[model samples]
Target: MKRIVCLLLFCALSSALPVYSLTFAPAEETAAAVADFERGQQLFHSGSKERALATLRTSVQRDPGHPKANQAYTLIGRIFIEQKRYPDALLYLERIPAVMRSPEADLLRGYCLVQTGDFAGGQAQLLPLLGQSFSVQDTELLLLALTDAAVNLQQPLNALFFIQKALPLAENQASLLERAHRLLQGHLSDIELEEAAFMWQGTAIGQDARLQLARRALGQQQQQKATHLLQMVLASDVTFPYWQEAEMLLQRSSMDSWFNRDSIGVLLPLSGRYASYGELVKRGLELAVREHNRTRLPVRLVYRDTAVEGVSTSQLVSSLTDDAKVMAIVGPLLGAGAEEAATRAQLEMVPLISLSQRAGLPQRGDFVFRDSLTAEQQIQSLVRYAIDTQHISFSVLRPENRLGEEMTRLFVDEVRRFGGEIVDIVSYPEEGTDFRKQIQSLLWEDYVVDIPPKPELPEFDEFGLPIEKKEEDKKEPEELEYPLAPFHALFMPDYAERISVIAPQLKFYGIKDVTLLGINGWNAPELVERAGRFLDQAVFVDGFFSASSQPEVQRFVELYRQAYEEEPTILSAQAFDAANMLLLGMDDATVRNRDDLRQRLAALRGFRGVSGTVGFDAMGEAIKQPYLLGVKRRRIVEIN
Candidate 1:
C-alpha cells in the first residue's frame, strides 16, 4: 500500500493539468477506473489540485458513463473557481450535466459569472443556494456572489444585506468573517453602524469590532465614544494598541478637569552603597527645583528612595505612590532596579527619567526616558576625537570576546566615517595563554631561513685518534616591518592587563612613533603602572578629562570634593546631568505629561551644566562632545 501511495505521489507531482480538472471511467472498466479516480481525489484533497485534475480527466476520458464522472467534472469546476480562472472555470463548470448540479455547483457557477461581469445572471444563479439546507461553505459562496453583484451595481444596501447573511455562516472563518462584518457595518448609515457596533462591543467577538468602531469614531472627532471604546480596550488588555491612546485621552481629560498645579517625583537611591551617587543626583535636582520655584514656575518636588539592599523594591515604590503622590519620577541610578521602577511608573501612568546607561528599555511609552549615553555613542565620540582633534588615522588591534568584537566593529565604522583606515585587525582566543604565536603572525618578526655550514677540517690528537673540528652555527637576525608609522595612530580596545602586555611588545617592535589610542575600558590605573615606559607617547580618550579648568566644571570638582572628600568620576557627572535635566524640565506645568517633557528636552539648546553644555538629539541621547585626555606623569591630563 505504501509503495502504491509513493507511486501515486510521484505521478501527481510529475504531471501538469488544469488546476481543477477531473476524470472518471465507465463501470465496464470498473476496478481500474475506480482506483485511478480514487487516487486523483486523494491528490486533490492533499492540495495537488493540478495533478488531481489531470488524473480525474484521464479517468473520465477512459470511462465516460461512470457515476464518478459527473462528480469529477464538478470537482474540476470547483478547482478552477479556487484558482480564480473564471473563463476556464466557466468552460469546465458548464460541462457538469444538469443532473449533477448541486448547490455547490450553482455557487461556483455564480462566482464564475460574477468574475465575468454578468452580475444579474450570477445573482439569479446564487439566489437558490441561499436556502436553509445549504452548508455554511455553500452559503458563504452564495452570499459572496450576491455581495459582488450588488457592489458592482452600486447597490451598497444590497451588498450589506448579503454580508450580514454571510456573517453567521462565516463563524469558523476567523479573519475573513471579521473583515466581512466590518465591511457590512461600513455600508450602513452612521447612526445604524454606530448602534450595531455598540451592540457587538458587549460580546467576546465584539472586542475587535468595537476597536474598529472606536478608530472610526476617533477619526470623525467623536471624542466621547472614542474615549469610551479606548477605555474598554485597555480594561480588556492593557497591552492593546489603543492602550496608549486611552492613556493620552485619560490624561487630557484629567488636564481639562484639573490643570492648576504640576508635580514631579525623584527616584534616587538615598540609602545604600550607591547613596552618595544618588545624593549627587538629588543635589542637581534640588538646584533645578530651586530655580523653578524662584521663577514662580508651577512645579512641586516629590522624592522617592530606591535603596538597593535596605528596602524591598515594592515597599519603596509603595512609599512613593502613597506618600509622595508624584506626577513624574527621576533618578534610581542602578540599571536593573531603575528599569523596574521606570516600568512601574509607566504602568501607573507616571513619567520616569532613568539615570542609568542600560539599553533595551521600552521606549514606546512617553512615560519612560533615558538620559545616559550608550556605548555606541561613546565609541562615536572616541572615533571623532581621534580623527578631528588628534588627527589619528589608523588602527591595529584584537578583540578578546563578543563585546571586544563589537567594539572593534564600531571603531572600524567610525574610522571609515572619519575617512580613516583599519590597517590590521587581529583576533585571539580569550582563554589562550600564548599570544606570542598570534602576535608573531600579525607582526611578522619571527621568521628565519637555513644557512649552509662550513666544511670541517681533520686534526690528529696525541692518542693518534683523528679529531674533527666542529664550527658553531652563526645566528641571523629576523626581518621585521613597522606597519604603524604610516598610520598616525593605533587603537587597542582590550583589557588593561592584555593592553599592558601588548603595548610594550609593540614598542619593542619599533612601532613607537605612532600614538596609541585606547577605548573606555582601558581608562584604568593598572595600565599606567604596568605599561609605564611603553605608554610614554601614547594618548587615549577617557570619559572624564580631570584637568579641565571651566568654571562650572571646577565648581563641580570643588563641590564633589567637599561632599565626598574625593574627585568625581564620569559616571557621577552623568548621573548629575540626568538628575539636573529631569528636574529642569519639570519646572514647566506643561511638562507634567511625558510627551511634553520629551519635546522640552529635545528643544534645549546649549543648556550648560556640570558635564559641559548638554543637549539632546531625537533619540533621547546626550550631545556633548568628548574631550581628549592623555596620560602624563602617571596622571590623566586633558589635551586643551
Candidate 2:
C-alpha cells in the first residue's frame, strides 16, 4: 500500500524532475541584476540560503535566463529537495541548461528522481555526474543514490562497482566486504574479478581481489599463476593484519583458507650425510626468495634439517605436518623422506612439493607433487636414443636393486615398442666388483675356449708350388678370435662405481664396437676416470648438465659458481630449477594454498626451466627432458 502511494506520487511529480545543465544567458545580460546576484551569492556562502533565494529571485526577474539566475535556480532546487518539496525543486531545476548544471544541482535532482522510484531514470541522470568533484557528504549521498538505483534495477554487479568505490571511505571495511561478499559470491565471473583487481589497484581491496583470482588459478593447477598473484602480497607491508597469512600462502601457496598461515617448512638433510646436497638446494631456495623479497613479502622460512639431532626423516616430516603454522612443505631430497611425508600431506590436504622422486609418492593424491627426475623418465630417454641409433638388439645390465628393477621395466617397454629386442637382461649385486662372470655370460668370453685347435695350413708360392709349413708352427694349435655378443648395444642403468667395473669387463671379455647406453646416473665426470677408455662412445641421458651452453643454463652456472665457489652438479641444478619453478609457476597460478600449488605443479607442461623443460607426466611426476651426453675421447659432449 505504501509502495502504491509512493508510485502515485512519483507519477504525479516525476514529470517535473530536472533535466539539468541548461545554457544560461551571458554575464553581459546579467548586468542589470548584478547587485542582487552578488548579494545572493554572498548570502548563500554565508549560510543564509532562505535570504539568498529571495535575492536570487530578484536577480532572475531583472535579467531572465542570466547565468547568475541559473546559479540561483540550482541553489533553490537543492533547498527544495532538502525540504521534500519534490515538484517545486524539479520545476526550478528543469529550467537550468545542461551545460550550466552544477554538480550539487545534478545530485539533488538525481536524488529526487530515485526517491520518487524512477530508479533507471535517476541512475541515468546521475551517470554524467560521476567523475565530478563533490564534498564528503555529497559523495556519500551520491554513492547511496547509485547503490539504490543499482539494487532496485537488479544490477547487483553495478551496485558492487559503487560499493567498491566507497569501501575506502567506509567506517568498517570488514563489514562492508562481508555484506558485499554475500551479494557477489557466485555472480562474479573470472573477467569481473580481474576488472575488480584493476578498479581497486594499489589499494588493499585490490590485493583481496587478486587473492580471489589466484584461488581460481590454483584450483586449475596453474602454480606459476598462483605465485605471481601472491607475490604482490609478499611485496606488501608485513604490518598488514593479513600479512602473516599472505606470507604463508606466498611461501607454500596452499589454498585460500590456508593463505593466512605464515610459515613454510624446508626439510632437507642439512646437518649430516647429505649436507652438501642440502646446501646446493638451499642456495637455490635462497636465491629464489631473495629475488622475490625486494618488497618485504611476509613469508617466513623455517628450515628443518632432516638429519637434525638424530631425528629420522619420517619424524621430521610428521612434525612439520603437525605444525599448524606451516602452510607448505618443499624439500626432503631423499626419496624416502618425500615418500614419508606424502601420506600425511594427503590426509591434511596440505601441499607438498618434494624435490625427490619415489614411485607412488605423488601419484596417490593431488596433495603431493615432484619436480625431480626419476628412473622411469631417464630410462625412457636412453631407450629412445638407443632405438633411434638403429641398435635393434639391446642387453640390459644393471645393479640388482629397486632402481635397476624399475628402470629395466621402462627400458624393455620402450625397446620393444620401437621394434627392438632385449637380447639379454642381467643384474649384478650393487656391491660387486668382478662382473667378468656376468659379462662372460652375455658376450664371447668362452668363444676362444669353445673351439678345438686346427692344424696350420701351408701357403702357396707364386710359382704354384706348395711351400713347406714350419714344423713347429704346424704342430702348434691356432688361437681363435671371438666375435662380440649377438646384441648390438648394452643399456646400463648403473652409476659410475658399478658401471666402471662392468663396462671394462664387457670390453675385456671380447665385446667391442657395442653401443653402450646409460641413464642419468652415468653423468658423473668421474665415470671417465673409473671406466677410462671403456667409456668412449658411450651415450647417456642426464637431468641436468651444468656445462650446457644454453644462454639460460650458462647464466645459472655462472651465478651458481660465483655465489658458491663451486661447479654446480645435477643435484644443484635440479634444485635450482625446482625452486625457480615454484616461484615463477605460482605467478601464473596466483596465490592459493599449497594443495592448489600441487595441482599447478602437476599440470605444468613444457615450462622452460633451468634444469630442463619442467613438465609433469600423467602420474604427476616431473616429465623433464634429460640431456643425451656422449663421452668422446674421455670428454663429455651433449649428444643431439
Candidate 3:
C-alpha cells in the first residue's frame, strides 16, 4: 500500500509540473535550462542580442523539451531577426512545436517566413494576429510585411488596402502616398480602380485614382465619361493634392474648352526690327498649314504678333491660349521672348514649340518645346564626322567674343567626349580683320626656333693688338617658316564672313592637308565662292541644305519656290517642320486634346522633316541629325 501511494504521488507531481519533468534527463539539466532561459530573457529585454542568443541556444541544448526551451527558441529567433539573420531565425523558430507556440513566437516565425520568401505561409501566420494588441511599431511592421507580400503576389488592391491602413502610422505620409500612387496606377484593372476610388473616397488617393481613370478614358476617346469623372472631382470639397491637374483634365475633356485640336497659334515678331526673320518663319508656317489642309482636315492659324509696342510676350501667349484656343503655338523666334512665352504657356497648360535656340527653354516646363538646331547639336555633328574620319588631334581658332568663346567651349567638350585631344586653342578679336598672329600661335611659330647666338669674335690678345670685326654684306633676314602643328584637324567656329578670310590665311601659313571643321555659319554661298579652293574637302554642319537631292528637300524647295518665288533658309525649313509636326499629329484620332497632343509630340520618333530627321527628347528638346556638308570642287555639297 505504501509503494502504491508513492508511485501515484510521483506520477501526479510529473503531470502537475512541465512535460520536461517527465523526461529522462536529470532535474539539474532542466534547472540549468530554466536558468539560461531566465538570463536570456533578461539579456533580450536589455537589448544584448548576441549574449542572449548564446544563452538561449544553450538552454535549448540542455533539455530540448524543457518548458523554458520553447520560450528560449522564440527569443533566439527574435535575436536572429534583430541581426537580420533570417535563415538562422527560421532554423530556431520552426523548432518550436505547433502546440508550444506563443503569440510572440508565431510573430517571429511569420517574419522569418516572409523574409525567406515564404510569403503565403507568412501571411497565413500573420493574418490571425492582426486583431491582437501589439505595440505600434510591431503593428506597422506587420502591416508593411503584408503589403510587400501582396505586391509580390500581384495583388495591388490588397496591397493598397494594407497601405491605406498603415498611412496614419507612417512617419512620412507624403512619401507613403507617393509610393502607393506609383504602385497602384496601371496595375489595377478598370473595375478595380473604380472600387479603389470608392474605398478611398474624398481622399487624395481616391482623386488620383479618378484622375488615372480619366486619363485612360481620354486615351481611349471616351470623352463624355472622362469629363463626368473629372467634373465629379472638381465639384468635391476635398482639397486634392493634384487639384490643378484635375482642373486641367476637366478643361481638356470639354470640346468648348481652350484646346482646339485643329487650330494653331503663330507667335512671332511680325512687325519689329526682327520682322524679316519672323516673315520667313511665317511663310514656312503658312506653307505647312496650306499643304496639310490640302490632304487632311483644315487646320486654322491664329497669328499673334509678339512685337506689339506695349504688349509682352506673355500677354500674347495668353491671348493665343485663351482667345484663339490654339492646340499649340509655333514660334517666338527670339530667346528672351521664347522664355516669356514658355512661362505663360506653361501656366495656361498650352504647348509651345519654340523656334529659339535658348539653352534651357525645354526645362521651363513640359509644355515648352524647342525645334531649332542648337549650337551643341552643331558641334556634335562636326566632331562625330571628324572622329569617323580618324582625325583625333584638333586645334581651335575662335574669336575672343562671347558667342565665339561659348562655341569654342562646346567644341572642346565635344572633342574630349569623342576621345580626341585638343592640341592647341587660339583666339582672335571678333571685330579684328587680322588673324596672322593668332594663326602663328596655333602653328607654334612664336616659340619654335631659339634666338641665334651673336657671332663670336676672335679672342683678343693681351695688348688688344689684333682684334678686328669685319662687316659682312647685310642680307635681309630670312623670314622664319613654321611647320603646321601636329594636329589632324582644325575647328573654326565663326561666321562665313570671318571664315572666308581665315580660310585663305590658313593655307598661306602652311596649314594644308589637314581636315577643317566648321559650324552652320560656314554654309553661306560667298564662303564657298571666296574661299572654296582653300576649304575644299572641309567638313561642316548645317540645319538645312536646300540643294540636296533628297526627295523631301526637292518637294519643299519646289513648293516654296512656287509659293514665295524664292529659296528656303534654315529658319523657314525648321519652322515648316515644327508646324507640320503639330498639324500632322492632330490628324491622328488618338490626339483629342492639347494634353494628348503634348504626349504624342513627346513620343515623336524618326519624323523625316526637310530640316533633317526630327524627334523630341524627354525634355521636349529637338533631336535632329543636322545636314553634314563638305566643300568639294569649290562647291558646297552633301557628304553622303
| Displacement of the residue 544 alpha carbon in candidate 1, Å | 3.3
* Superposed model 2: Cα runs more than 4 Å off: 1-257, 260-264, 294-300, 308-327, 401-403, 444-479, 588-599
Q: Which residues of candidate 3, in runs, are more than 4 Å off?
A: 1-256, 449-481
lDDT of candidates 1 onward, in order: 0.63, 0.70, 0.82
1 or 2, greater by TM-score: 2
lDDT of 2 by residue, 1-640 (tens): 9999999998776565442213355666568677788898899889897888788778877776564667777877776566555656777777776656778888888887876678998999998888889987688678878877886786766877787777767777776564454333233567887887787676655666676566556545566897898887668652233444345445554433434345567788887788988888888777656665666444556788887775676566557755544666787888766776775565444566788866767654555667777777777787777777788888887789987888888887666545577778888887988887788777745554555545556689999898986767555455655565779888887887677777777777777888888877777768887776897768888778877777878888887778778887776777666666566545543646554465566667767777775676544567677888988778788877
Per-candidate TM-scores read 0.52, 0.54, 0.61
Question: Where's the lowest-lDDT run of ten residues in candidate 2?
Answer: 178-187
Choose the strongest candidate by lDDT.
3
For 563-610, candidate 1 gives per-residue lDDT tens digits of 668667776666556556766776665654444454576566686656
Give a tens-digit lDDT track for model 3, residues 1-640. Answer: 9999999998886676655435656789889989989998998899888888888899888988776777888888878777666777778887776766887888888877777678898889988988988777778878888887777777888888888888889887776676576554435778988998999997877887887677657545578998989988888887666668678767766754456777899888889799999999999999998998888889999998888888999999878887777888988899878888887776566778999998878876657789999999999898888888899999998888887899989887777655577899888888878778887888787677688956755758699876664567434567766575679999988889999999889888778788888899899999988988998858989999999988998999999999999999999999999998898789999787776787788789989899984789756789999999998888899998
Task: State the weakest 10-residue window (summed lDDT) of model 1.
Answer: 252-261
- What clash count goes with each model? 11, 35, 0
Give the CA lDDT, 0 to 100, for residue 264 in model 3. Answer: 92
| Winning model by TM-score | 3
